[model samples]
Target: MAPLALLVAAFLAYSVPPYLTFDPALSRVPAPPGFAAHYGFLVAHILFGTIAIVGVILQIWPWLRRTHPVVHRRVGRVYVFAGAIPSALMALVIAPFSSFGPAAAGLNVVAALLWLGSTIAGWRAIRQRRYADHRKWMVRSFAMAMNTLLSRVYAPLAFLGLGPSYPKLGELIPAASTLAGTMSMLTLLLLSQWWLDRKPKKPAIAR
Candidate 1:
């Protein structure tokens, strides 16, 4: 997970600078004409989502959780209120106008809703002192939040896998990207469940 997180951080370092620059010329996907607020929403979503990812790393660290439970709880609040909720809300606002196509838009919408919903569920569970449920739901929330990184990871792989066989690569890229997002969500969901069900190995007895 550390290596994967470092890789994602590297990807963000490379990919996020243009958006931060606030120059439309550097925008990866320009705001559709007539929707002036789209760029603002996109930037907000990116920033908050980045925060949520960082929070996840710290929240899940065994040393932090074990040694500093109070800090963990405080960070959890920030992750919920300052990061995931805002990012997911902004995602809802922007997803319908996706440049890729309606399919991509729909996928984004679903992912955002699930991300928002799972995070909320986790928060509620913790509030009610249902620690087990909280962990499960938070795992799901993390998986949903990670869709951003996973989708980006999948896009290039999809291109490489499909480029040679498909004659009209340009036309297919949008659909392929949507498929990649779908696959990312599904893959992450499965992994999250596996995590939830995993049991710690018992220590071997000394003979």
Candidate 2:
């Protein structure tokens, strides 16, 4: 299930139409600035972000990590150096285009800030040989990366649960989507951190 979910996530990240690339339904609202910056940053964000996601997902697999340490290290380099860093940085730029609303856009700014910090921290942890801390931060980073996926999931469910289509509450889609996305981010944070806590302590830092 984990692998399948990871695959789907990677697929979405790669194949999902560039929401900000055009003034379509998903990205209809123009928040101050227009589409050029939005499109550029979004392109950078999704491409590298998806690569990082796929790398991290494979890194999390115990079998691959255990049996093929070499592969893990190589992908880790790509994840941190090539994918995560650039993706998070680009997210910072495009976050303002969150069609949901200003609140959503603002929260996205916060998330991008945190995501960049965590990915960098995770990279530093590995360098310092604190494998445990590295893993913990990577989990956090991955969870935040699921922001897009979860929000999409929640919005449709919210629409259905409320009534049916846009006719029920069309204008409020932003609010509903924002609410759902925020909940998803928080839930993922708590659950991932809790999972870390359940693991047996191993000298805090590896050394």
TM-score per candidate, chains pooled: 0.93, 0.80
Error of 2 at 167 (Å): 6.4
Per-residue lDDT of candidate 1, residues 1-207 (tens digit): 689679778878977888888877888876888899999999999889888988887888888999999999999999999999999999999999998788989999999999999999999999999999999999899889789888988998877777777668656787778878888989998999998889877778832
Alpha-carbon shift of residue 21 in model 2 (angstroms): 10
- What TM-score does candidate 2 get on C-alpha atoms? 0.80
Off by over 4 Å in 1: none
Clashing pairs in 1: none
lDDT of 2 by residue, 165-194 (tens): 346464567667767777777887888888
Question: Model 2, which residues run further than 4 Å from truth?
Answer: 1-3, 6-14, 17-35, 161-170, 199-207
Each candidate: what lDDT? 0.89, 0.74
Model 2 residue 164 distance off true place after TM-score fit, in angstroms: 9.0
- Which prediction has the highest lDDT against the true structure? 1
